[model samples]
Target: MEFLLTVLASAVGGVAAGLIVARLTRGNMTGGLLGGMIGAMAAHFTLYPSGEQALPGLLVATLQGAVGGAALGLAAGFMMKKKT
Candidate 1:
């Protein structure tokens, strides 16, 4: 249950952050969400320290997740050969 909550929280936070970042970066929200989810999963597995839950707060986790998501999104965007 805790793990589920962590993933859910991270995913939601990441999606929201991704949306905001994408808008600011002149990118697409849909793709951003997907990338954000992936990033959130990665963060959940690798970034969170032992005994820490997802992150201290939504904003911090979201921001970090957003950074990762944006990176992935940008890479995807470049690979797709689409103009933003």
Candidate 2:
């Protein structure tokens, strides 16, 4: 249950960050979305703080996920952009 909740929170954070980055950068939304999900999931599993309470843990997970997502989304968007 807790793991599932953490995954869900991370995913939501990823999606939001992806959309925001895509909108802000005018980059590929699909790339942003995929990058965001990958980054968020990676961060959630690897970097999530240990031995924390429920709400705070989830919040921390979400924030880290968002930061990871935004970073990867930006990179992916930049790479996928068509040169014009």
Candidate 3:
């Protein structure tokens, strides 16, 4: 189903965002994960279109989610309060 595919795509996007954030932030696992979740949630709400076919929609959602998630994660990284 398109819904499931959308979730999967969002998860993949989250994981990718997490990894990238972790690497960029010198291995902040918790920050990366939380950022990824926020990013995924953002993509889920923002990108998924209704009544789409399975494969193409999945592909589109994945790409959109990936980009959106990364951008959001990056922004969050900058915006989040630093713990000193």
Candidate 4:
């Protein structure tokens, strides 16, 4: 139950962060959102703090979402770039 809620929250956060980053950076929203979702999930599992691991406080979660969204957006940008 907790895990499911965490995932759902993270996914929603990821999507929101991704869309914001995409719009700000003029990148593809769909790609950024997908990448953000992956990164958010990865971060949640790998980098979450010890002990109180119940969805990470609002600030932490937002930070996580932003970091994940930014990282994914950057990756998407590089991948979408045309080789010259």
Give all candidates' CA lDDT scores.
Answer: 0.62, 0.79, 0.65, 0.67
Error of 4 at 31 (Å): 1.5
lDDT of 2 by residue, 17-64 (tens): 976897699998888998889888877767654523433367876887
Candidates sorted on TM-score, descending: 2, 4, 3, 1
Which of 1 and 2 is ahead in lDDT? 2
Which one wins by TM-score: 1 or 2? 2
Candidate closest to the true structure, highest lDDT: 2
- Can you tell me which runs of candidate 4 are displaced by over 4 Å? 48-59, 81-84
Summarize candidate 3's per-residue lDDT along 1-84 as a digit string, tens digits.
667777787768776876587668665555566677677767677544443543346667666666666666666665564667
- For all candidates, the clash counts are 0, 0, 0, 0
Ranking according to lDDT, highest score first: 2, 4, 3, 1
lDDT of 1 by residue, 38-83 (tens): 7666776677766444444656555566666666655443344456
Quote each prediction's TM-score.
0.61, 0.83, 0.64, 0.69
Of 1 and 3, the candidate ahead on lDDT is 3
Candidate 3 vs candidate 4: the lDDT winner is 4
**Alpha-carbon shift of residue 41 in model 1 (angstroms):** 0.7
How well does candidate 2 score on lDDT at residue 45? Answer: 69
Model 4 lDDT, residue 55, Cα: 53
lDDT of 4 by residue, 51-74 (tens): 255457656765776677667765
